[model samples]
Target: MKALQITGAGEYGIANVPQPTILDDQVLVRITLVSTCPRWDIAMLGGKDMFDQTRPPDYPLPPGFPGHEAVGVVEAAGPSVQGLRPGDRVAALEHLQGQGAYAQYMAYRERDLLKLPDTVSDRKAVSTELLKCVVLGLDQFEDVKGKSMLVAGLGPAGILAIQVARLWGARVIGIDVSPERVAAVNALGIGEAVLADSLGDRRFDLGYDCVGAAPSVQNVLDRTNEHVVIFGVLRGELIYRDRFWMNGIKLESHKARPVTERYRRLLLDVLTRPEMNTECLQTKQISFKLYAEGVETLKRQEAVKICFNPQEAF
Candidate 1:
């Protein structure tokens, strides 16, 4: 079994190791494909903490340290693992700790993974892990129907947010600083969008902030008619304006939830939607050996997301 290890900043090496053993409640999955998490991969390669970028990162990121998004076929399942078995096409709907999913095989808790229907292709289902993350925020609101929702960034997460919000019956308006991203959102035809600088007196029933900066959060807090959900990595101290208080504008920070049956169902529900396809976001796919090259592409902003085929060797 080959697993990826970041020996140092900007350096990586693959080593053949014994395959992982499954526990009573775990499943050993034969990985077919794994996807890059731009932020985490960039941070690991840059030798910085993903959450605290200013801090230095530890070297040799626990083989397969950051590779969580995956689609695989279950090779074996422990006795306690019910409802999942060998030959089931699946993806880990949640992050498995130090999963080393970048390898050809990984052992993950049965509860952390979910079997996928044949209708979902590996390329499309590869994004399901992220879809679960995006749903964490959207599901926070009981209902978004007929609401005017502002998506405060047009990156991958924000784009998914726009689609989900729309699917949930909300009219969406996406905003981003980059015209390219704004144009991308507009091209999707799922929502209305405008450049951040071009935003003039635009307001929404609620705002979903995917850009975790002070300006972005403040922008939503100021313009939203009723509520706001902070889904981005909040970095700076935010000031709550008096007007926000006077208007009774509500705000909620997205919370992390452990993977569960509900999320598995949500992942399938969202992926099965014809209007919710994100296949265009997968700009590149490469053999797992080319991870360094893919990260370089991500650093250059050359791709929305890169998929890695783990079964292919050097």
Candidate 2:
């Protein structure tokens, strides 16, 4: 099996590795498409540990690391694996322990895989992890039927936030620092998309800070009327001003909620609707061996997410 590995900072190399053996509870997934996770992919390639930017990244990360989003066919299933068999289409709903999504195939526990509904295509199914994040985060909030929402960043997650919030009946408004992203979101017309700073004095019933930066979080905190949820990874300390507290505003960070059976059903429901735009992150596809080129495209803002095809070399 061929797997991608990071030999050093700003480097990508393909290695011929041993094919994984399936455990009794596991299924072997023949990876068809693997997508880039900007946070981990860009950070790792830049020599920074995404978990702790303060520390230098360790070299030679596990093969197929930092490439978690994937959808593939099950080539084989262990005898103990129930409800799954070879040729069943499945998508990884969670990042595997080794991030082995970058390889040609991976052996994953049945619990971590979702059997795809026939209506869902590979492109839409591939981004279930992102959808799961948005769903679980919004699940933390009270019903948003008539509420207004402020999504503080317009990246992939932010884009999904706007659509999901609207679908749940919130009057959605989103902002982003990148003009290109702003234009892209505006084109979708899912909500009021504009420059992040342009929201000046507008207020919303709820705020979702999708950019994990302090400024973006603070910007959300300043404008939200009822509750603010921090959806972005916490990279810096947030300043909750005394004035904010006096206004009776509440703040909550998104917790990784357990993937329950109901949530699994909800994901399938969302994927069935094209309006949710589950796979909006992807922009282009390249061979798995050319992952470095794909990363460069992401860094250049030429693509939002790159899909790597392991079956093709050129």
Candidate 3:
């Protein structure tokens, strides 16, 4: 088997490796799609510690590593694995301490895989892992129906937030510095999308910040009526006005949940819906041999969602 191996910063290639073995509670999956997580992968490739600050920087990430969002068909199941078979189509969770989904085969705990519905296509189902986070973030807000909500940063998560908030009956507004992103949101026909600088005198009952930068957090705090949800991973300190306390403003931060049966069912229910618009979020699909190129495209902000097809030849 060939697996992706990052030899150093800005360097990677395929290496021949032995296939993974499944444990009693695990299943072997033949990977079909591996989504690029730019923030984590690009930072690691550039020799930075963005994903986990506590862990010291490790060079040359292990073979078949650096991917979390993935979907595949089950090739084999361990004796203890139940409710799963050799032909089940499922989404995978990243095994942080083990080999990941960026390979032809991976061993996953049976509980970590979410079976895809027949109504969901491979392209749409591949987004289940990320969409679960968006769903969880939206679930944190209360009484959103008929309320005004602003989604900051029109990235993939931001766009999904816009759609989910709208479904929750919120009058949604999207803001992004990039015209292309705003245009893409507008194409969804769900809400008003605008340039961040052009949002003059505009405010919302709630604000969701998809970009975790300090500036993005400050922007949401300034324009929100009272409640703001920090949905993205923040890398810097956040400073706000002293008057923030006087206004009784509330701030909430969200992190993706570990895959569990309850959350898996919730995610699959949403993914099977036509309103999720999962396909629109996918921007490009490339062969596994071009994984580095796909990561480069994401780092340059040239694409929104890029998937590597491990089954395809370069």
Candidate 4:
């Protein structure tokens, strides 16, 4: 089996590694599609420990898989793995165990796999794991119905947030530095899209900052009326002024919530629904051999969501 490894800062290579062995409660997945998460993966590649600071900066991370959002077929199942068997299609939540998904095969606990519907294609199903995280972020909001919401940063997560917020009956406004992303959001018919620099004298009841920079946080605090949810991973310092303190504004930072049976089922249901509209979020699809090229494209903000097909040879 071959897997991706990060040798150093801003460096990665494909390494031939042993195939994963499953435990009694585990199953082996033959990865079909893997989705790139730019923020986390890019940071890790640059030698920044975004998740945990205590861990040493070691080269060639364990499992060495950069992608966490993946959909695959069950290649094998262990003795205790019931209800799931070989040939079953499933979405893998590999990030929960600090494992990687950018490989031909990986082992996962049976409980960590979510069976995908036949109606969902592998390309769309690749977004399942990240959609679950989007669902978790929406869960953090209070009484969104009839309220106005602003989503700063029009990446995949932000775009999904706009759609989900609209489904909740909120008047959504999407802001991004990219004109192309703004146009895409406008074309979705879910909300009003505007350039970040042109947001003048506008205010929203709730704001979600998908871009974790301090400036984004400041933009949300400057325009939102009530609360702002920080959904992106922040690596910089957050500084505020006296008005921010006096306004009684609430700031909440959110990470992907724990996946449970109920939430998993809900996410699948939402993804399968016609009105959810996930197709617009997928900007590019590439092969595992071009993984670095895809990452570079993402770094240049040329694509929103890049899915990889591991079966394709270079």
Candidate 5:
């Protein structure tokens, strides 16, 4: 099996790695599609613990297959597994020290795999992982009705967050530098998407930081009138205690939680929504031959959400 292996900090490549065998409680899955989580991957590459660091190192430490969002078909099931069987289409939680899904096959615990309805497509189901993260954030911020909200980045996470905010009945605003992304948001009827730089001192009731760039943090401070929910992966020493303190602002941070009870319900809610399931469509598919090129595209913020097709090489 070919897996995208992160050998060390700042180094990762798609190599022919051994396929995973199912354990007593684990099920073997043939992955149909896997989305790129560049923020999470970049954090690990930069030697930062964005959750899943306390788990006592199951597969390996520091460097391993690092992707949490995936959609797949079950190939085999362990003896103890009851609900899931071979040939069942499922979406598996790929975080929490699990095998990477950016390859042909991976093994997961039966509990980690959720049986998807026949209505869901592989891309849409895999995309729900990003929605799960947004749902987690929404769960944390109680009662956002009628209040205005802003999503500071327009990536998959940001886009989903926008839709969720609107679904919760909040008058939402989405901010990003890319006009192309803004257009996509408009076409999808998610929210009022605009370029972050184009806005001139318009204040928001609640704000979200999805980019994690230093400037993005500052953008939150500049626009937020009350609270800011940071659903994105924030890195580096960007802080403004005074700015928040003076305005009586609140900052809530979120991390990936696929195994916990709180996150499980949130994931279910997101999966149940039809509007969120089909939010954005990529213009180009990144094949394995262009793996390095895709990585560079993510690093440069050129691609909104890029998925590497392993079969393209096979």
Candidate 6:
């Protein structure tokens, strides 16, 4: 089996690795598509010790796989696994001890799998985890309809957040450093796009900063009026201005929240509506064999959602 491995701190390499052996209660999936996560790259670049709890205590294991968003087909099933069998297409959460969505195959506990509906495409199915995170954040606030939301960055998560916020009937404003991304979001007519640096002294009711930079987080605090949601991963200290705390603003940071069964069912139900049109979430599509290229493509600030087919080389 071919797999992309995080060999050490700040390094990644491709290798033909041993296929996973299945247990009686495990499920094996033939990976079809996967997307790169920016936080994973930041963790690798900063050294494994940078993250507090999320980083596995055992640092820098040999040839570890690092991906979480993926879609696949169930190629084999364990004896104890019920209701799922070979050829059942599924999308799954890709965070665990030894597996990553970057591999040709992954073995998972049967309980973690979410069977994809026939109405959903593989690309949209791969995005469930991403959408789930946004839904979790949005669920925290109540009755945002007709209220204003300012998403301060238009990365993959930011773009989805923009759309989801709009779907909830909130008037949305999106900001990004990339002119191309601003143009793209403007074309969608989902919200108003603004340049991050151009917001001299404006404020909004709800603001979200999806850029992981400490400065960007501070900027979100500085520019937002009342409620601020820090949705992106930040590594270092962000200094806030003295008046920042005096604004009577509620600050919410992203914490680890498991997808509850209720939310899972809600996500799948909303996804089943064929007219939802998830294609806007994707910015680039590359073959799965070009995994390294996919990783590189997402490094660009303008890239929204980069997908990999996993069956061909770059």
User: Model 6: runs farther than 4 Å from truth?
Assistant: 8-12, 42-64, 79-83, 239-248, 273-277, 287-293
lDDT of 6 by residue, 6-37 (tens): 65654566777788888998888887887666
Q: In lDDT terms, how accurate is model 5? A: 0.71
**Per-residue C-alpha lDDT of model 5 across residues 195-225, encoded as one tens digit per residue:** 8888887888888788776679778866888
How do all models score by TM-score? 0.95, 0.95, 0.92, 0.89, 0.81, 0.83
Instruction: Estimate the overall C-alpha local distance difference test score of candidate 6.
Output: 0.72
Q: Write the per-residue lDDT of candidate 1 for residues 86-157, one digit (tens) a residue.
A: 999998776567666778898988877778899888888887777888888988877899999888987778
lDDT of 1: 0.83
State candidate 2's TM-score: 0.95
Q: RMSD, model 3, all Cα superposed? A: 2.2
What is the Cα-based lDDT of residue 141 in candidate 3? 79
TM-score quality measure for candidate 3: 0.92
Model 2 C-alpha lDDT per residue in residues 124-237, reported as the tens digit of each score: 888777778988888777798899889988877888888888888889888988889899877766567889878778899898998889888988888888899898887778
lDDT of 4 by residue, 289-314 (tens): 67667778888888886877776632
Clashing pairs in 3: none
Better of 1 and 4 by lDDT: 1
Residue pairs in candidate 4 whose N, alpha carbon or C atoms collide under 3 angstroms: none
Q: What's model 1's TM-score?
A: 0.95
| CA lDDT, every model vs. true structure | 0.83, 0.83, 0.80, 0.79, 0.71, 0.72
Query: How many residue pairs clash in all the candidates, one count each?
Result: 0, 0, 0, 0, 0, 2
lDDT of 3 by residue, 153-255 (tens): 8888887888888877899988999998788778777568999999899889898999988898888889887788898897678766677778888888985
By the lDDT metric, which is better: model 4 or model 5? 4
